[model samples]
Target: MVRSEWTKVWTTPGTAWLLITMVVATAGVSVLAAAVTGCPDTGCTVDVAKVNLTGVQLGQAVVAILAVLVVGGEYSSGMIRTTFAAVPRRLTVLAAKALIVTGVVVVTAAIAVAAALIISARLLPLSLGNGTVLRAAGGSVLYLGLIGLLALGVATAVRDPAAAVGAVLGLLYVFPIFGLATTDPDFQRHLQQIGPMAAGLAVQATTGLDTLPISPWRGLAVLAAWAAAALLAGGLLVRLRDA
Candidate 1:
């Protein structure tokens, strides 16, 4: 069942487009950032990792669409009934879908993030030898994968591709915007500490540790928590509802 579903996903036009968008957007933004920015000699240079991965913020919308379409597409076409009939076990079906989607997203994100980092290293003045760069590069990939999973979970719960995609993107970006809009530095800092985009991107921060609103790893962890919670909620909905 898993293999069959995997094959279907790869063969699907939407999946192909999603994957291509993810790769292209990531690489394109990284290249642009590298071209536009220069590294500083004293303070932490323009975080090459962050620059290369800036596209992830935009790429995540594509990931969300893909993830939502994986399940929601079937629902929209009334094919989920057939899927449930064949799989029978609701939990198993959801789990299989999650695993397959996560696997693909993780692999693709890893490749995209790594390529962006390597390109940035060559194009930028910063030294790739720094441990912070390596961590940021790896973390960016993981973050993209997690965003995919979160979108998948939300889609499962919403059961509507358009709504799911909107919700996921809203969740990822809205909070960050809210953070920025606030005049209170403390509130903005608080939002940055907990907002998914604001917090998750913290992993890319290579300098100004003391002045940062939140620690890099902790911020990423917060985003992970949001993903886990969404998945848990979606799983509950999947288990309780009828197709």
Candidate 2:
């Protein structure tokens, strides 16, 4: 049953389009950023990896939609009942979906991040061999994959694709906007530290450490916490609710 579900996901037209969108969006954004933000003659001071992967912010929305549709679409179409009938175990079905979705998204994200970083490194004045560049590129991929999982979980609980997509996008983007809206430096700093985008993007900061709002790894961790919490809530709801 799990294998069947995996095949269905890959063969689905929506999944195919979403995967293409992810790749195109990630690569295109990286190229545009590189072209617009060239490095200085003395070498770039900006985090090249981060700049290249900037598309992830937009790309993640597609991922969230893809994740939501995996299950939410089924619910909307009344196909979930057939799925439950075939599998007979709600937790197992959810686990299988989560694992398959995570695996696919992670692999796609990793490739996109790697290609973006490599292409940007060549176009920009920065070197890809730098440790910081590696961390940012790799972490961006992981961060995106986790975001997919979080969206999947949310979709499971909501059982509505439109609502799940809106909720996930709001969760991911709202905090960052709120942080920017605040006038207080201290409060803004705190919000940046906790906000998924502000914090997650910290991994891409390779310059001005003293001026940074938070450490890169710590920022990624904050995003991870959000993803984990969403997944947990979704899991609980899935276990408690009807198919």
Candidate 3:
């Protein structure tokens, strides 16, 4: 089942194109950001790691769309019914898609993040040996992977490509906008603590850790929890609804 899903993902040209675009968009934005930003000889307080990985903010959208298409496309094309018929166990099918989608997204993200780091190394004072930088880089990759899983689960539950994409994007981008619009600091902080994008991206912070609403690792855990819950809900819904 996993092999079948893997083949389906690679055979799709749009998915491949999006993966390439993810790498380019991520690396390109990082380069642009690093070019404009600077640090002093005395060392700066700016979170250089986060700045260099800034392209991730855009790259994640692509990841979310691709993940949505993974399942939603099947539903749109009426292939999901055939998939369910062949697999018999609906949960197994979701698991397979989740595994394949997460695996591919993580690997592609690793490449994209590495490319961003390597290209921005000269523009920024990036140290490969620095543990903080390492953690930020590693965490950013995991962040994109988790975003993919979250989108996949949403697509599974929604079963509509356009609506699923909108829903996931709202969780990622819109929620933060709402947080920013809020007047209450406490409510805003609470929103960041639970928001998938805001919390997940916190893992990329290498400085000003004292001010973060949630710690880096803890923020990533928050995103993981969101993904897990989404998948659980999607699994139940998939079983309850007809393809």
TM-scores, all candidates, are 0.93, 0.93, 0.96
True lDDT of residue 52, candidate 3: 90
Q: Candidate 1 or 3, higher TM-score?
A: 3
For each candidate, what is the lDDT?
0.82, 0.84, 0.92
Off by more than 4 A, model 3: 40-43
| Residue-level error in angstroms, candidate 2, position 27 | 0.7
Candidate 2 regions exceeding 4 Å error are 41-45
Give stretches of model 1 more than 4 Å off.
38-45
Q: What's the lDDT for residue 154 in model 3?
A: 95
Q: What lDDT score goes with residue 239 in model 2?
A: 77
The residue pairs that clash in candidate 1, if any, are: none
Best by lDDT: 3
For residues 1-243, what per-residue lDDT tens digits would candidate 1 score against the true structure?
Answer: 889679768876678878988988887788787777755434345555677667777777778888888888888989889988988888788888888988999888887777777776676655567898778877888888788888888899999989999899889888878887889988988888888888888888887777888888998898889888888888899888988
Q: Report the Cα lDDT for candidate 3.
A: 0.92
